[model samples]
Target chain A: MESRPTRRRFMEWFLGLGTGLLAVFYGGASALALWPPAPTSAKLQDMGPVSAFPTGKPTFAVYTAGGAQDGVFVVSQTSGPPTVFDFHCTHLQCAIQWSSGASEFFCPCHGSTFNIDGAVTGGPAPRPLHRHFAEVRNGHVWVGGLSS
Target chain B: MSRQQGPDESRRPSHLSWPEWWAERLGLGASWREALYHPVPRRSSVFDLLGFMTALAFLNQVVTGIILMTFYSPSVAGAYQSILAIDAVPAEHFVRDLHYWGANAMVVLVGLHLLRVFYVGAYKRPREFQWVSGALLLAVTIGFAFTGYLLPWDQQAYWATTVGTAMASYFPGIGSFLQGLARGGDTVSGATLGRFFTVHVLVLPLLLLALLGLHLLLVFVHGQSKVEEALPEGYRAKHRTGDHSDFPAGDFQPFWPNTVATMLGSALVLVAVLVALAATHPAPLLQQADPLNRANYQPTPAWYFLWIYQLLKLFPGRLDILGIVGLPLLSGFFLIALPFIDRNPSTQRRKRPFALAAGAAAMVFVLGFSYVGSSSAVGPTAAATTASSQAIAHPSFAHNVEPLLTASCQQCHSASSHSGGLVVVSYADLMKGGGLGPVIRAGDPADSLIIQALNGTSQQVTQMPLGGQQLPQSDIQLLSNWIAEGAPDN
Candidate 1:
């Protein structure tokens, strides 16, 4: 019983509303997928016993927080406090391995070398390896990967 | 028609007569074909083909850019990840590579076209506006390059844009305004990226399209200007013998086949070159940026802006404003106004001293700056090391020293916030030092950190910041005294 233009306007309005809702859903999904809510602070797990990392030598340990591997290499000095470092090289994300003979954490990918304290000692590395915040809790060593 | 259907009526379909069917549907009859083929003067040549191909390249950029934009995140954290996603998407790599190469090729082709127009005297008479418009288009092309540089949000993009925005800050009174406008705020951050993306994809594209339309319209309206030729005495006599006509059609061909062939051929060549570039030398990706880390940040401007960057560096800090902004603006204005300003009727590059000098200077400056800027490190390492040593030596005056160190030395030696890899902000970090070795030599003041830093005697890999500002005499003395005091942690 309504005029032709009025009916057409109502149909157009409904169509536009439907399109807007569809776009919002899709865009929101894409944004969420691209940037998942990463935790501000990830708790450190108990990465084995203290003797597992020997004195005056470096040991590699892998810890998981929220199902992601946070690779850490811990070096225990003979007479000083133990220093822990993220195994990822500063130049690129290549995994660094401990070379006792060379006395450094060497990255084969770009020849970047890190000293015992996780500082860059040689080659193309731009910065020292990142330090993992660690604490001795309940006679076990726990390391936090990224700070809040 | 009275006896039986006429030939025309019989030839028509049974449902409708030719004129009735045409008029009923299109509101026009069969007479439209005559108007459609109406002859227009043809002054275009193979040289004119570049403009058409440039248009086609822009269309490709638009299509590819839109597709890429669907996945692109204009955030510091998400920008690099989105690029990785684009690479992973099936067949998206080819499109992205094409867009990248197409942009570079468009700049090159436009440059050549402009040079050709200048040489052939096409900027004379009524076509001067087109010439000026072409100059603006060139600026827009460079603008596109600048905006696109930050989309990756890597260290290279960040530092490069930092240097670029800093250069923009040299524009007299409006310099800071333009710098803020370019960055969308005080510093390069999320807002800057968003603004750049919007301008690159939307605002600039709209302006380009409008300007290009005007350029083409003017080009068509005022036919290509011919090179001035010396006439022989017999030529005028021969012209008198023959019929004189302003409109000549015998030498020209139809626009359909010839122009299309030329345009298509150039486009094919450009596509082949772009494909070769894509297949052989894929664009390199640097490491993801960390806000807490800036050890290996190398700031290199896009190839087009390298010359200005280099020029700015050559000039002292006092004249940086003139070198960075004023000279470039004056040159750009002159280049755009060349057609109007140069009353000389000749179009030869050799004959145009001012234009030739400007062009040569620009080319040389850009090439030189790009090479130097890319090779140089972010800041002066020696100066930073000295400043840090001085600060450590004079812990009694740490408060006064901190600000001075940060302003003059933080670019290379400080790990305060996101300045650099080396942490010289505190006495402890200064003693710990950066890649070059400890800035403190413990209990040996004479053989201390300041001496080692100033002489670059440390065996640790590359020396501090490696390039940039040099240290002043007072700062050097301060470092010497600090090292002389056995590099105290206090």
Candidate 2:
């Protein structure tokens, strides 16, 4: 009678242990499925040179990579390196137009104003126009669309 | 016999001379006094002191919250400034840091207490209501943390509150309602801050205080439950044979000396820990809020709710309505109704499969959501895109007029379908014009629709692009150069 009870007790202990282990393992897996890591890089293609855009002027260009139009921007240069800024306003991502006489990037969608260097000059833009990194390579200028 | 009775009655204290005097004046029966002064078992230890420490932590929150409210302003223009002023107070930084670290410590201590209760099966039998109330208290603590998040009104606070309110909006039919309630309007602004202030200072604290009172009352009435024993076979046999009672009387010391000492010790340890945390890593200061700037905002919710915020982002827009609102509401409702759902007498972690499962799931979900949300905040970096010299050398006809049209007039005049029926797809079509006449007068770019749009002098119902997108100096110069260069199409 003692042996029979011992065997039953051992079995119950084993079952409980097994279930507890299983519960922890499944719970951990479920948590992992909920959160994922952020992406590191966005791909952008070369458009052309500083001279091609001309000084004291903004030129609108379509950004296409791998046969897709990802976004559009107005490329311009003032004193230093040529800068490319997204035509979209920072507030709502609405496309902005260049008003030559006013010398700023203006978003008609919400009346946001960005100066020649993409800094917020007036109105509702939360920040300066997002300026992408531009580099001069082999006499050709390239602007990267990633925000640092 | 008469002489002996008279002497005995004279010798006794007047307050205890009769049963009526004892019951009414001293306010205690003989049996109740015996129980109150009863000798307890010797198994009680320092680890059990966590309960009292948890209560003290809640009290600390109430005290610090009151101090903070004295200086905090809920307005958008003043909230950030107010926090700065608070930080500038004498020993204000230390106090703020302590409060911040104390809040975090409370969460950790409460969680540890719950774990201790669960392991010892304290949630079983008559103590079940206490267990349920403790859970509600835990939820309210987290709620306090959430409401306190937006008080700073800095970039981090602004965005964090935005994401938090967005998560609140994921609750089924009441999702939008909760969102509005959280924001006090359609968007997060000054009104939202005021509403959260009321909740953090008034609503949640009151609820927490009431629940805490009930929890302490239950503990006093029931006393501590006995810790489960690991009975050997022989002990079990004896128990089965009625040689031992199934329920052992809980071993505990009196509330005055032994228990209170342990409680005080735990509170001291918590203070030391908070001091260390505040000294080592104070809360970070961020840039002041500027309504016109939002480019580099990296908003993250408090650690407690990060998982929920992360979870909501996992669902795509198509499934957002359900993923964001429906499921969280159901879970919250279930949490509130947990006592009713769990009617079982056994509170053993091993026996309560459903409760244990739910707890484990919640833990995992929170961890996962936090990981994902943090990862997504950094976003993707862009690869270098070099401009082609070849394209510059052989400038297309499209480039020349494209800048002029896109810059000066694309805002109000779309190329695809003209606003006011004036399409400017090509130079010919532009010159042909719409209701207001030709956009470009051939070689005379000065007197043409091009010049009119750039100067904002057009009487075509509204200004070009109507309100803004003012042309840069360089862009205007480029337009003039192109026009002066005989409007070249090369």
Candidate 3:
């Protein structure tokens, strides 16, 4: 009996201690990991002077903020502010490209096409491309904030 | 095991032996050996040496670890510096090498020891807790390795840990939660480094000490199990009793000088080998850990962990939880519960065919997996190659802007020297504009800030080299041509 784990209650207490310590160690780490996400300070991107974008054409403007790449189609065809569509396609989330000949936005991956107004035109795209908050001020095109 | 000696402290008088001079004075010495010592089974051989090998390796690790602790710093800024400082110690070069070799040896010996215990059916019946404690000690040893892997803060340590912790996030139901727990926060940062140091130096050491104590106590109390016994059948018989005295007394030998000699010889040989290896090939140190610069890195786990890494590769991405969490946990649970489940006190290899085969198969599998993992292309290297190739298909700021910017503009337009509040070091910074306005205007060189500045028509200051020669007209045209091409990044 002496050679065995005969002290049953003592064994249970020891097991409890082991379990408790492991629990605390892992539990504390999990809690720390779940802390609120840090706030990012991404300032608005001022693309360029208004004259840089040809007024009658679909001029594609690309910019990066905080190492993340984003693009917008700044169309100044009419008298109003330029229409800015986010470069991400409605299908599969790949960055979209401009087709100067086709006069439409197309996904390089799945061939989803959209009209200049961001409306889905053909392919398997379910909806129009997302847009960004864009405005023309002081002869420059300022693109800021997502409007998905 | 004696205390008294001649006038020369190192030499013992020929007339006085340990039993006469020492044991007579310390009257309880007989009982002391009787209490602490045990009889070695007649069948004992080099195979039973694994237990001693593991213990000696552990002792080596403890000595080296304590020595390292005197100099190692726990903070992120100091971790790499501390290791470098340790290496810079004059004439005592092999101290760090001993720790590295000690850890590797401990891992190898512990695994071999476990296999010995398993093949002999030593976990059966009364020695169950010995097996349990041994299993737990195995885990703590591996814990020591895992935490220690991150101490140097080098490229291997940083990226290997990144891949390892990312693998942990594949557990079912609590996958991401467990990952968060291990990582401290979302990514491997200062917090993770500090905590892993604490675990490696303090927390794991304490746990290992306690578990080792328990393991040793259990071993001595149970006495080295008799591996010669094998029941007629592979099943336990009812009303059977365990009595150590029933074995023939002559078949056992007192473990005074015999076992002690074996332990000393084995320890000496292991240290000699380790020293030779360490002196020839020292450990490595790569570049410091930087999360953003990981594109060039190809992370791989340590050798012992390569089997699990290979297992993860074998499974689909969605079923990763099975390989990562389920497989190891299930195997651990089975080993822990083997005493209760098997109940067969058969030390004969033939009668315990399943147990022997299973152990052998596991060994083969782990070695095979490690072979595959080591020989294969580095993890994430293929994906990184594809991404780099795709990047090459587009316009590049490195090729276009870097030449003009470094020669004509880097003197004033840099991260350190952001004169005019403009930095052309990165495309992102170039697009953020200067004190006056944004720089390059895509598709229109006429309205570009950089082009206009070079043309020297700005309101703020002179831009055509305040003191140096103006950039040639051809160079200015090249810059204009790049802007007129939409300024796409490669």
Number of the top-ranking candidate, with TM-score as the measure? 3
lDDT of 3 by residue, A53-92 (tens): 7664556666553433445677775676677776655543
TM-score of chain B of each: 0.65, 0.63, 0.68
lDDT, residue B89, model 1: 69
Worst 10 residues of 2 chain B by lDDT: B382-391
- All DockQ scores: 0.02, 0.04, 0.05
The number of residue pairs in model 3 that clash at the backbone is 1
Question: What ranges in model 2 sit over 4 Å off?
Answer: A1-148, B1-41, B44-47, B227-252, B290-293, B347-358, B368-490
How accurate is chain B of model 2, given as a TM-score from 0 to 1? 0.63
What are the per-model C-alpha RMSD values against the true structure? 15.2, 20.6, 13.6
**Interface RMSD in Å per candidate, to 1 decimal?**
16.9, 15.1, 12.4
Ranking by TM-score: 3, 1, 2
User: Which lDDT tens digits does candidate 2 get at residues B72-105?
Assistant: 7878778888889888875677677777887887
Task: Tell me what fraction of the real C-alpha contacts between chains A and B each candidate also makes.
Answer: 0.00, 0.08, 0.00
Model 1 / residue A96 / CA error / Å: 27
B1-490 per-residue lDDT for model 1 (tens digits)? 4687578864547787565566557865433322222223355556767667677777768887888888888886699999888888647777778778878877877877887777666787768899999999988988888888778777667656665665666667876567666765544667678878888999899999999989977755553454112322343233333323321355443334554566678788877888888766666556675322223232435555555655655554254456766788888998899887878666676677876676677667667777775444223343343223222245332643344454445656655453334666666766776544555675564465454544456454333335532233234445555555565444
Any idea what lDDT model 1 has? 0.62
Candidate 3 local lDDT, residue B231? 22
